[model samples]
Target chain A: MKCQDVRIELLAYLNDELSSEDKVTIENHLSTCGFCAKEIVQLQKTERILKSGLESWAEVGEKVNLTEWLQEESRKLSNKEKKKEFTKGFAETKMLKHKWQKVIRFAAVALVLVMLMASYWPQLVKASTQMPWIGPLIKQLVLRDAGLSWAYEHGYMDGSLATVEQDGVKLTVLGVIADPTQTAVIYLVDGIEEDFSVYISKINGDGAASWTSPATKTSVGTIGIAQTYPLPEGEHTLTVILVEEDRDAGRRNERLSLELVTDRENISKLSISYDLDQEVTFDDISVKAKRVVYTPTQIMVEYTVIGGTGVGGAIPQEYASYLLTESGEKLYRVRSYGSHIADGVRELYEVFERPADVSNLKMVIPVQGKHQEINIEFSEPTTIGILDTDIRFAGWVHEGNMIEIEMHYEKYGRVKSITGWSVVDEGGNTEELTIWKGESFGAYENPGDFAWVTTKYELEETDRPVKLIATQVLTIVEGNWEIILPAIN
Target chain B: MTESEFMERLRPLEAYLYRMALAIVGKDDAQDVLQEALLSAFVARKQLRDPQYFRPWIKKIVARQCGKQLRNRGTVFPMGRGEEYVFDSTDKGKRPEDHLIWQVVNQLPEIYSQVVILRYLGDMSQKEIAEALGIPEGTVKSRLHKGIGKLREMLEAEKGGLANEMSGR
Candidate 1:
């Protein structure tokens, strides 16, 4: 038995639960392995030494009589009850003596409580905000997220949460929590009554363009526009194009801008230009995370997809990527923008959520570009192959001039989302197919859980016997890379 | 459950409940805590889901009473929290073997120490600990692991800070 296997059964072995054969095998393994032996010793020591601290039921149950004890307690309560009954005889005299004193004491305590609540209302808000370690005794009397709160507990928050007024209604930027797949800007709104969609219009800086989130309302008023990848360093004006939804008046677009500054001094950003030079292959594509960076905000990994295009049947076109933390926490993409350098070669930048426990950090990228041709006719359901998720062609509906090609987008593990797909007719004509966007959010809004999404596409007039080819399939390969991260001091 | 039925159910487990109270608030207040817990348990007997759940359910009330009694004692430790405050604080040298475990108790926070004591000394499972404390099983597991890890670290005496903490006034 291996050390790990032996260690798992060591507890049972100590309790004499394992079979004789398995026990002998574990004993042999323990004799050879010091680690497993020490584990058993530690477990035994903890049980033996700590048992002295407790007086168990075996000792007290026989010595103490349960029936007599209950009657005794009952007798004590009855004595107190008799004393209370006796006191009732002088109730009128006692009440007259203590009425004014009691009222004065009650009023004084109530007044003190009210004053304390009024003064510490902001501190109460800080306590509830999820910065784990900060105790209530920090003494900074501030509402929302104070600078001292983040600085003391979290150690670093580049652009700490701040409130801004848009027109008359106010919205506070809670904090920027990012991941490669979905980088959501978690925020809360105040004063505004109607529902609104918060999307980052533009972040003015180098390599700073944050899809995220088609504005998702997480808690009561907390909304985050999960911007994919990492925002560039330094101060930048974030142009938030807030779209308020009104059932009667349709939708109203309100542009509220806020200045977001990534303070480097406070943030524990270690500029480790360390290249891991590792690669994972999917079909003919060689995808590898070359450069890595860690800041107070997020962990960024720059990877490249090297695969020839139009290879047909072998190469994947599009991919949704994510990185796993040491604790196996899956950080999905909130938003990301890729730059195409050469044919079939693209350089994409993505940021993963910084690990709370960064012991064994690992990144898994399927972001493999693809091309799979499956021929489909007018009236039959077509399915894509080689992909984790089964993208099936449900049916089509006739809408005036154009027909809406309805497809059932079911998210399995591999591919997270589908932006668009191309249908090539036999006569060499291409039809423009897109995930139809309407009043309700498209496949992009909530990318993580694509449980059962009905995606409608406006198919252009195409020739018969058309080939429905998936432009991109986000299928993860068997290859995995373990990136040992430095301590985020 | 009726008052008599509640007393009947607590018959065998009263000693164990008394032990938990004794551990949390010491022997001086354990009897008071036990009486308070029994009174509240009798009053709140309706909150018990089933007859089978009476043990852990009543134990949870006992723990809460222990906490309330401790708070009422008003023994507020300061910033460093150097003073040992929990678990039979009066019985300093009851047994020779008690020193190491008591030192461990002194190091840990009240919550973590309670979980550790229940797990190791009381010989309770993580699920049982959660049931007794009225916490999620995940929280119990985390606290158990954290307590064990902290205890192991302090026992190994690898950290130089441990010497200062041990020897400091």
Candidate 2:
């Protein structure tokens, strides 16, 4: 046989499994072939060595305990049985604990329900007054048992009707007044004659005003007005005034007058309007109104409405107009609500005074719903203080919050100061500052025309000859301050 | 079987069973298989019908147990890899023949090692070896033949390494 053929059967040959004839033939070939004979000898020697080596390795496993594990498994099953019996005994205790837990949870939920009803009691009462029908249903379905508690808290109920005089007309409002924390809407009503004027204002103080005015032939009826004012913690006084006058039928007429007083607290006045002459006046009315107040906190402005000839009626053609001047510079036009004499006689008449400067504006409001022009003058400056005074720069003077420099200035030499400053890229990082109006230096109040003293500016800049500024450091009571560097400018 | 019965059956054949497990699972896991297989067999003794065939049955059980452990452990064969061959070169004074033979055997593949171990350690017949490993008798014969051939080749390579070393020195 060839060496390859013999090699393939060498294991069988070694195990003595080869047929006798084949074995004899292989032995004869091995004796003749030196390579095959040597190969066979080497293979036998290697196998013998490997076998002995592996046997020794296997002897190491002789000590392994295989049977002991079976007994342990059996013992575990019995232990599990024992645990079952023990667990059964604790079931009652667990149930008792669960019951107490449920009771505590129910108590907590009930308390939360009670607290929520108590908190919203005032709002619920107010809502009930307005929507009397749904109030009971809402409380029943929602508050459930807590409804009685809410009712007990708001047992007393009272309401009143008040008037606020605007220009010369009296506007009346009827409702339960709201406090500083609550808000309420008051509807206007004509109280005296048809087409009379009404004035509404948020009350600032408590006072009384006489409700007497002579009615003119061209004047309309009067309406109730309500004003909202702040009350610190107690009773306060509020005053109301009345005014009666005739329409300015393309000519100046006797002016209407009203007086109001408040001795108690601060009140915000919200509404003011005059009764429009419907018969002899125009129908179409349009008003162009804008928000003029531009402080970061709030924006306020006053606008006037100008109107045209009344629609086909004995109400002579009367044109209505209003003017809003800032720093003596007028800005924005006033007009009625619609355009046409047949529409209605209603003017966009509201005044606003924000901390910012406003000038060179005039708008047309139609008294008779039709065409009208709002006159505006833009040349006059409107800021009251120096344009650069109220500005504040932080990193402009120091490296971090450890040091801050507040610069304040006022307008000078007949120039209106448009004061505004922003923290722009402090140390290459943009920062924002919230402007404040406190008793701090350069604080403005009742910002007004060029002749007036206070105003807000779009940015801090100067063109005035006599600019003035006041500055102070804001120190935190518990924080440390370091002098990084003095402000450069 | 009861705990006492299990111990009685295990004590006599423990050595053989351990060796078989070592052959299959390597030294680290051989003992683990022994304990696990014994516990399982003890719990399920009623299923073992032939008492006289205990040794063969236990061997089969140990093999199956080792396979299961490997499978459970996500045992990948690490393709084309086998047990490392450790040659004892410390005995420099021994006849070079002994060292060369040792090196050759060490170089054998794991499958060849199993065959070598069964032949020498267990002293089982060819048919018994085939039955324990669940392979055909012919397959076992072929494995033995190939294993022997590889050993001879490794021995020749070892001689070459020694000669080169001596010449370099």
Candidate 3:
């Protein structure tokens, strides 16, 4: 091979990315040429330099304060009582306070939740509402979305099954609640300390379903699995596989799996038959409530967007669409599946928290707003006005190698969502600008076109002639249409 | 994955993710970007059903988060002189800003810089880099080759006067 050709392939050869033939050829050429051989050594040194340079910068990963993040996330989800405490407690743990706030075994390869039969376990309890050790946990899950924990207190669990011990762990089905719109499962485990990875190894139902089990961070041994859609409503097979992984080897060493027949049924068999044939409009966008079903597990609403088409592509006011209580509390949305059913017909199936105090409930759909992307030339402090919002590029803090750019945006309470942004330097090198919510801004009374935001992004180099692109800045439309949900029962 | 579990997977990669983020975004935003990427990985944890793909999965998430900060017409950070240090782990008498390889790598195009960063700083295999960057392995091979070539040339040009280009590495 020629010196030029061998030189081009040297990196690949060093990186072992070359075929054996190319590798041997490069090796043969390097043996004969000192310049090419010296070049290979230089390339190797270059790799080392780059690695160490980046590593020095990466040590700042220690600066990422997850405690504040946990607290903030908890604060965001504080609307829900149980999860708020769960996340809050996780935020304050001494273990999490360790370096990088990192701990526990890893088993990212979770198949899905498993199954259990009535006759599997010796202590399987059926047709009983005896709140098990973690029934109250599922109670919170049910109370928030399915209906309210009141149902568990008043009635019985339809399929409370358990499984025999396998892989040094015992799993008991604490409570199972299934409505047509949503399904939830709360299970109590006897073994498994430390947040070892638990996966739903196999879910064998006629219909497709997935579950999100956060490993009951606050309360160990109790896991609450809930989703917007239910599995096939009959006897179905499923398996919960618990994997004990050896991180060093990066593979699962011991696996415990128990398959059981999950008799999927709506334990309460009661859904609030609420139907509203009403239209609400804000500006040019109109939202009509087509079909509203209140299952114990979730609130399923089929909303038809009249004039709010192509505003954020099928999801008009998704961030603003939620079930609002008379007391002005926003319910958490579980999932929003928006599909184009047919020509001129769009379907948005939204699942949200259904509070027990089902009084004066309204489906609030705000008007879809028109937004614009703007580029700001900022080297020093600058302020730009977009509609009613004032975005101030505050200042820069040069710490070590990072240039911290502080930006604050103040608008109304409604338009507080940070759209998107990116930065570029004088060298034409694009930066992945991560504008974090540096500090919390108190409430604002003014109606906003954008939002009240204080954000910061760090750059290694301040190549001048910087441009900050604030994509999707202002919401031009204002006004929320609220449709009072009336009960048919 | 629980927060702790996510953190566990992230523990080993904290420095790696930070490097990748810093290489792409810079310092001031590395913390925020790393946190944002971690949160994103946690949110999308369910999608990662294979344990083996965890590293590549998280790296891809961080890269994608950086991808969001992809506006091409701006400059940020005055390059905190204090933060500029040699890749030396030790705080010896060596000058930090002489990180020539680091300086040259950044000047490389995004295509090469990303491949190189993911390979060395990320400690990722060529295949892993391919998976993380969503490129073919063969493409990864070519990009790494070209990236190193530019880096080496840039190093030689800058260090023509200096005898030892890499004192630390």
Candidate of highest TM-score: 3
Which candidate order results from sorting by TM-score in descending order? 3, 1, 2
Sort by lDDT, best first: 3, 1, 2
Off by over 4 Å in 1: A1-152, A158-167, A172-188, A205-228, A247-252, A268-273, A276-283, A294-300, A308-371, A374-489, B1-169
| Over 4 Å off, model 3 | A1-148, A160-169, A190-194, A197-239, A243-254, A258-268, A274-290, A295-299, A304-360, A367-479, B1-169
What is the TM-score (0 to 1) of candidate 1?
A: 0.31
User: Which has the higher TM-score value, candidate number 2 or candidate number 3?
Assistant: 3
Whole-model Cα lDDT of every candidate shown, in order:
0.48, 0.37, 0.53
Ten residues in sequence with the least summed lDDT for candidate 3 chain A: A95-104
lDDT score, candidate 2: 0.37
**Model 3 C-alpha lDDT per residue in residues A1-489, reported as the tens digit of each score:** 665567557766777877898788888888997767766776777767776766665554432334444444434444545544443245422222112222223232321112233325566566233333344455544544334354466563455565557656765655555555544555555455433333344456332233333333332344555332444457656555445534334345334555555554444256655567987665556667787777665676777765544421233122236688878877635555554445434556666667777678887765555545666556678776666456666665543223444556453333323345566656787665533221223333333333333433334344455555555454545455676877545
> Best by DockQ, which number?
3
Residue range A324-405, candidate 2, lDDT tens digits: 3435432221111221223333222222222243333332222332222222111222222221233222112222221123
TM-score of chain A of each: 0.37, 0.18, 0.44
Q: Report the C-alpha lDDT of model 2 over B12-107, residue by residue, as the tens digit.
A: 777668766666666435655666666566666777676776666666666667655443442322111122111101111233444344334544
